[model samples]
Target chain A: MKAACVENGLVLVRELPDPEPGKGQALVRTHSCGLCASDAHFISGGQNVIDLSRKMGGPYAALHYERAFVPGHEFVGEVLDYGPDSRRSVKTGRRVTSVPIMRQGGTHAVVGFSHECPGGCGELMLLDEDFLLEIPEGLPDDHAAMIEPLAVGLEHARRGRPEKGDAALVLGCGAIGLGVIAGLAMMGVGPIVAADFYADRRDLALKAGAHIAIDPRETDPYGPLPDFGGRRVNLIYENVGVPGMLQRIVEAAPFDGRIVMGGYCMEQEALFVFAAQNKRLNIQFAGGEEPQDMDLALRSIADGRLDVTPWLGGRVGLGGVADAIANLSGPGTPVRTVVDPRLL
Target chain B: MKAACVENGLVLVRELPDPEPGKGQALVRTHSCGLCASDAHFISGGQNVIDLSRKMGGPYAALHYERAFVPGHEFVGEVLDYGPDSRRSVKTGRRVTSVPIMRQGGTHAVVGFSHECPGGCGELMLLDEDFLLEIPEGLPDDHAAMIEPLAVGLEHARRGRPEKGDAALVLGCGAIGLGVIAGLAMMGVGPIVAADFYADRRDLALKAGAHIAIDPRETDPYGPLPDFGGRRVNLIYENVGVPGMLQRIVEAAPFDGRIVMGGYCMEQEALFVFAAQNKRLNIQFAGGEEPQDMDLALRSIADGRLDVTPWLGGRVGLGGVADAIANLSGPGTPVRTVVDPRLL
Candidate 1:
């Protein structure tokens, strides 16, 4: 089976032994796998993703994403075979995506970040049957690849609890930001304001349903009320985990606002605590989504309410993943770039 | 009538004409009034209480707190007379405490902060009958005066949603902090740890039901988990509102901790937002409480489950309020200073 393997600091496609299905697991043939920022983090040299995972001090502490680990978690695949003692949740050849949790020595290890099991960045991978969810009809392979990321957005939007007519500000135009916009749009939350540094990402945000997209370089988002059309932002989604973005959004929130933080900031960032205290805001941190959230994301995409194909910058095969990751790391890179393992 | 008035940055009891009950209002003889920090803010006069109120922008924007207004909001009194068109919620001579919102020419005004109606800092005060809550039989006068502040703590505790086995941390030992301790005690949340800069305040916190009281000046509160007895802090109540206090608490909190910010910080303060984001914390700011919360506070006090009498530093007459506020503002002062208008 062809898989993208990391050697030293570079990722390249190589023929690896096919992963076998363990108990309560199913063998899956990969369809489409999305390249994520975390994948870039693992591939880059300075900081090791496995060491950071251990530093987080969770079940991840014992788990390992070793030097040669496969890199993708957001991927769609088909059930190929079931292991002994499996529940047989789905038939062979069923189109599916799954929550990637592997039990290791009485603890759970996240699939893509675990060294014991290869992730969907390969032609063949093994997944827990209980974590599987069938992709619905009318959703393409590109959009199906987005089910995991979109579920992240849905979970964050659920945490914010945005109501109709409440003004919202999303302070990033990355993949997570686009997913949040799609979730908010499905919920009928209006007048969504989005901010981004890049014009292309800003356009993608608008396509995802942002009413107004501001390039922060040109305008002052923290100037005053008139900057946001005199409307008090009751809900804020901070997708930019940078230093000043959270502080700026907190300044624009009104009394009793809700701020959902979805961005993964690897470094410590400073914010004005007094500002958040004054508004009496509810600040919630969003990490990942539950199974129900994944179901909702798939349903919304199948119903045509969420269209993320525009977010897909390009498609590649396992052999092209390395270049795609390199290109995506540069400035003016596309929102999402995917790889199909079956392609030559 | 004797009333305490703020004139040119001084609060002294002065003889004034007896105030009469207006339409839909009642005249009450004050029993006990608590000296709050806002009173000090009003007397110091960098910004007047009304300006701050208006800046908050609610009913206070249209309501006026004239320069000579009396300053006490947490008080218990007996109804002396009823004005025309007053609803017969309680009879004359009924022991009650009101929420203190009075409509003045189509706009509502807060009682202690409103110039139009004298507060309980005086011998007599005008209260809207609609704002009144009858004191239960078993609750004493001093404890009844705490109903409002206790309600604040109850609201914050409710927002934090601490279960039975959850370890809690309180970051201040002020009057509000003691009230929060009492609320947490009533909810049966154990191993409550409290920190205070003042030794006297720490003593009061322990008396109020904190299992452990740490003087923050003697030890580094943010050092490591062993400093807090190697227990995870799942719930934190931030009542200090000072610079670096909230940040330290966020650092000490365990995974998915709930932090309730109850104190009001007047200036901007810096915090580590990444620490909070990584923990996936739910940070809620507690302001005013609901009617149900107020009822719960009173009920908790009436049933002898929550007692805050130890938090009272000392008692003073109307004329002594100025010196009391000044002394309480300084170090080595008691937690709460109450004023009994009947005393000389």
Candidate 2:
């Protein structure tokens, strides 16, 4: 099978042995996989992440930095075969998406980060049968692949506990931030404000249902909005994973604001506890998408309730993975670069 | 009127002019006031707090460092007189407690920390008539004074959102931590695990209905609890306000744990955003008690549902304020020192 493999800090397209389905696993052929910014971070500082995971005794402690791994968790695939003791809930040849977790004995491994479990960047991969969700008919593969990332925003929105009168402020205009804006808009939360450095990303935010989009350089996103009518921003979604961003949000957020930290900052961050405590802030650190979130996101996209066509950017093949990853690493206009493994 | 004044970082017992109540205010005679740890922190580093308030542009921005102010918010008092335009909700000479916030124009001031509003550390003080709650008959003054601190814990517990089978781990056994333990126990959240360095505080935790009170040095409070039946510590009340405590809790807590930050860490703190995001921890920083919390706390004590007699320790007068504050600043057996302004 052809795959884009991360080896020794470089992504190389090469021929690799096809993955076989294990117990409770189903072999799937990658239909479309989305490029993620986290993949760039992991490729650059894989060793540091592995060391931190080991020190924290987290689920990713088993990840080996030295080993080559394929990284693509946001994917849509078609089932080929099922392993022994499998539920085989979804029929073969049916398109599917999953929560990107493969259950191993007592613990579970994140499908993309683990060497043993190749991800959608490869032509073929193995997924846990229990986590598989059949894609509804008429939904394009690129849109089906987006369910994973969109689920993350939906989960953050659900965890944020948006009330009827909530004024939302979404930081950063990346795919995750756009998803958050979409989620907030879908839930009927009004007066959504979004901020980003790039003009293109800010445009994407507006298309994703943000009421106001600011460049952040010219305008302060945290400033009082005319639409809020003297009400403060009670719900904040943080998708910018930069250093000091958490502290900045803590300092700028109003009293009793709920901050959903959807950003994954790999570096150490400093905060003034007095600032957060004084404002009585609720800082919720959101994790990966859950099964239910994935289901809801796929349904929303399938029913045209969520228009993710604006987020779909350039499509790439296995050979173009390196360039796509590089384009995503720095500031660019592409919200998501889809990879079709079968493309030669 | 005699009062303990915080002037230029020194607490001095001084004779000040008798306060005259203005519109919507009531003149209250001090009955009992509790020496709080926050009061000590404010006295030691008031200038820094004031500077931070100014920078944050918070409600406390009006606090001035140069002006001498009375530092006691946790107090039980008697309504001596009411000014014009006041509702006079409580009868004259009736014992009462308030939320310790005085409405000034469009803004509000924390009663104890403001120069214009002297708190119960003085022989006489002014309280907002709208914020006062009449003390139930036969309730001791010292116990009534404890309502403010206990209400804080109750608020933390309510914000933490404990469920029927949720396990609570309280990180300290100070007045706030003990109140958390009491709140958790009263709400039937168990098995309540409390940690403290001092044996007396550990005893207080047990008396406050903690199922297990462990010295953190001897036993790891985050370790698997035999009483919890293999369930993780889902609800954690962090009353220990040390610098690295938030990061430590983020690293040690299980996935999907809710941590209520009740401790007021005066200094800046560092945290790893990845660590918190990976665990998906919810860090809720609780502020001072609200009016409903105060009412519920007073009712709990009045009905004998909550026994605060165990929390009361030494009794002090105007002259003893300095010593009581000092004792509270260091490690001691006294959970709360009650101050009676009438004492010579």
Q: What is the C-alpha lDDT profile of model 1 across A1-344, one tens digit per residue?
A: 88987655688788888888989888999999888776665455314334444554454454433456676888898899999988889989888897767765666766676656777788988888888999876567878988888887888877788887688878887888888888888788877878888888889889889888888788654333464567655788987655566666665667778889887654445554545654677888885777888898888788777777777878898888888877764456767899899996
**Cα lDDT over the full model 2:** 0.85
Tens digits of lDDT, candidate 2, B1-344: 99998887778988899999999999999999998877877766666667778887765688776678888899889999999987889999999999989988877888888888898899998999988899988999999999998888888878788898788899988778988887888788989998888888888899888999998889877788876675657788988777789888888888888899998777778888878888889998988688988988888888888788878779998899898887783456588998898885
Rate residue A102 of model 2 by lDDT. 91
- Two-chain DockQ for each candidate model: 0.25, 0.61
Where does candidate 1 chain A have its weakest 10-residue lDDT segment? A44-53
Q: Per-residue CA lDDT of candidate 2, range A211-268, in tens?
A: 9998878987777787667555778899988778998888888888989999877777
The deviation in Å at residue B40 for candidate 1 is 4.3
Candidate 2 residue B317 Cα shift, in angstroms, is 4.2
For every model in order, the TM-score on chain A comes to 0.87, 0.95
Error of 1 at A125 (Å): 14
- Pairs that collide in candidate 2 are none
If chain B of candidate 2 is superposed on the true chain B, what is its TM-score?
0.95
Model 1: colliding residue pairs: none
- Model 1: per-residue lDDT, tens digit, B1-344? 88887665777788888889878888899999888775675454424323444544444454333357777888888889989887867887878887756777756676777667777788898888777899976677777888877777777777777887788888887777887887787788877888887888778778878888887778644334464467655788998755576666665677788889887654445554545665678888776566777788788778777667666667889889888877765467766688888876
